[model samples]
Target: MWILISFWVIALAAVIATIKYRKPLLLTVPFFAMLGFLVVQIAMVPMPFWETVRFVFSLR
Candidate 1:
């Protein structure tokens, strides 16, 4: 669960940094990878999007 959250945070940071710096194109790789993984994870969730998000954040 935490790994999933971390993936999102890392992907977001990578995207922002990549945009601001415009040097490290490598960041796009992880951004796309995490985007794919996130889509799969969201698809697998039995509940709705908001509920799944709430559940993920609710973890200790």
Candidate 2:
């Protein structure tokens, strides 16, 4: 739940940052790229709580 919420929050932040900074593609692209890397890193680590909850409640 928290992870999902945080993901959306980060996405929203990226969008807002892009708009405010007037660098829509430039800002958002790298933000999402780094976010993807962070998610992969998290998956590689041993996070029982988040991993289990994420899998159990996965929407995709």
Q: Which candidate has the top score in TM-score?
A: 1
Residue 51: error of model 1 in Å?
Answer: 0.5
After TM-score superposition, what is the CA distance of residue 29 in candidate 2 from its true location, in Å? 5.8
Off by over 4 Å in 1: 1-23
Q: Candidate 1, overall lDDT?
A: 0.80
Per-prediction backbone clash count: 0, 0
Clashing pairs in 2: none
Q: Please, what are the lDDT tens digits per residue for candidate 1 over residues 1-60?
A: 987787778778887888898868848777677778777797699999888878887999
**What local lDDT does model 2 show for residue 27?**
54
> Model 2, stretches more than 4 Å misplaced?
26-60
Worst 10 residues of 2 by lDDT: 26-35
